[model samples]
Target: MSDGVRLNKRVAEDVPCSRSEAEAYILGGWVSVDGVVVEEPGARVGHDRRIALLPGATAMPIAPVTIVVHKPAGVEVSAALIDPAQQEGKQRFLKHHLHKLELVAPLEKSASGLVVFTQDYRVLRKFREDAPEQEIIVEVAGTISEGGLQQLNQGMKVSWQNETRLRFATKIATPGLIDRLCRDVGLRVLAQKRIRIGRLPMSSLPPARWRYLTPVERF
Candidate 1:
């Protein structure tokens, strides 16, 4: 017999469920080895060790939830953890299930709209790994010359923070591009907000309010 195996694999082999379900049970504090609770799925279990599923252990897999918050300007995404009141939702479900939340693609303090928080690792991984483009609407009060407009559309290299960087006029806007537009393009930006991430739009999510992402919603 092997000296040790991953906890999830051992649970999957002994229990009538997949490895993912086993992991969920473990994370939910349902699995114990020699009377000690082991929460990590990757925890090693000796072959000779006694592994037991607690009486209240759930056999079903828990689906991860993703929350879409219409974050108002000046509110930090990280503030949600310190003050759940910052999350603008009257739903009781939001109160009970807000623990272990992870923020994704946080907006700057000066900007507003569509901040995402999730318990799903897959969603977090997708955003981090993909570095998907975003859509932003910037309200500026300045005239652009015909030549400047053409140059914006064609993309330009601007000096930013003592370094040169490429700025594009496509729907996607990054902090660097926004800074270059105000400093180099000679535009006075009055407001800027992100409206879309990937194909997901802020849509009708009221300012400072939030809602759970529906099953049909992806990223």
Candidate 2:
């Protein structure tokens, strides 16, 4: 009997990689069970299949489940256990009740909008590594006492202490200027949501709901 339990799940369990990484392996034809390539992460297999992790592959999830939440302000996007009351207190902030699932990324308490969750580690890794330029839409309700907005228009330097995706922002006086706006607004960002990741936009998905990212959408 082949010992395999869905390519992605097996990969997630065996290695430190995420589910999305396994999917990439499978899709790239990198995963093999008993020397035969398997493309489906949900495909059932024995507990002891001689599974091999090949380089660069993609595995297809049954539903390709991915979630996009319009995270409101106040709650934290972390895996650490917290009080139920705390979670409940931020109910309005949550796009959905996500206490059951593990948060793959850390969303700050002050930041809000477009938090993703999934069992797919590969996807997580891709986001972590590629850090593809994304479009973040933030709406500032209050006015800035200082010339933060002016300095932003002139361009400001921003950095993260930890090694993460590189990002820059600029002001958007244009209607379609997502990147420019983030760069130009240095005042206290009142509200924000990642409207688009790569080419995928969160405008269609319901708030606090999950959707499977199709293979094409993985990039």
Candidate 3:
């Protein structure tokens, strides 16, 4: 290619490995281009450049891990990753389990619901490639006018940045919109919980506990 090919693709073509394995080697800091180590799989290199693997750079298979946690209110989603005491369930955390455990789709501190963490790049890539549709249940006190309900259903416009410009990226399921709707209708929101993401539901998952995704499960 004129602009150079992705490092991973070039590595896979040159080496006896799959693209994913090449990526793993790159991420593990085992790949060098023209004597310089390049960690990014998507790094560009000239077609005629030198590519080398360091000693002990044999393909080592890595198992992907995906964990689902039932988050409780008042706990910061990001903080809970390091603090196992904040997590639910009887399973204890091991030091080895902490490696590359990345939190996904973190919820607000005041919200309680399912949270996801994974060491799998494929799972993370799926989320990044497409915005997963979420379903949330909001509890509010007081009454909502019929007009307000209609407006909410039809997607009302809200202004931000000192009301100088309106946000074009408007949606009905966003938490901000829910809060605005409740405030406009003279209601007080008590709770908000995301119950579903994509086709996965937080069914039967107890609060403050965590579980691993089954082999057959996706997302």
lDDT of 1 at 111: 73
List TM-scores for all candidates, in order: 0.57, 0.40, 0.55
Worst 10 residues of 3 by lDDT: 162-171
Stronger candidate by lDDT (1 vs 2): 1
- lDDT per residue for candidate 3 within 1-219, as digits (tens), equals 247999999889988689999988887768899998887788888988899999888566546667787788788786354455654445434433456888767677787887778888887887778756666666667765667555555543432222121222222344355666667866666777767766678998778777766667775
Model 1, 111-209: lDDT tens digits are 787777888888888887875566666666665444654455544332222122222224335545574656455566565677777778889877877
User: Which candidate achieves the best lDDT against the true structure?
Assistant: 3
TM-score attained by model 1: 0.57
lDDT of 1 at 32: 86
**TM-score winner, 1 or 3:** 1
Cα lDDT listed for each candidate: 0.67, 0.50, 0.69
Candidate 1's C-alpha runs over 4 A off are: 1-61, 79-96, 154-176
Deviation of model 1 at 192, angstroms:
0.8
Please list the residue runs of candidate 2 whose C-alpha ends up more than 4 Å from where it truly belongs after superposition.
1-66, 78-105, 141-186
Enumerate residue pairs that collide in model 3.
88-208, 88-209, 89-209
Q: Residues 132-197, candidate 2: write the lDDT tens digits.
A: 445554554334336644554454333322232223332222223433344454334445555555
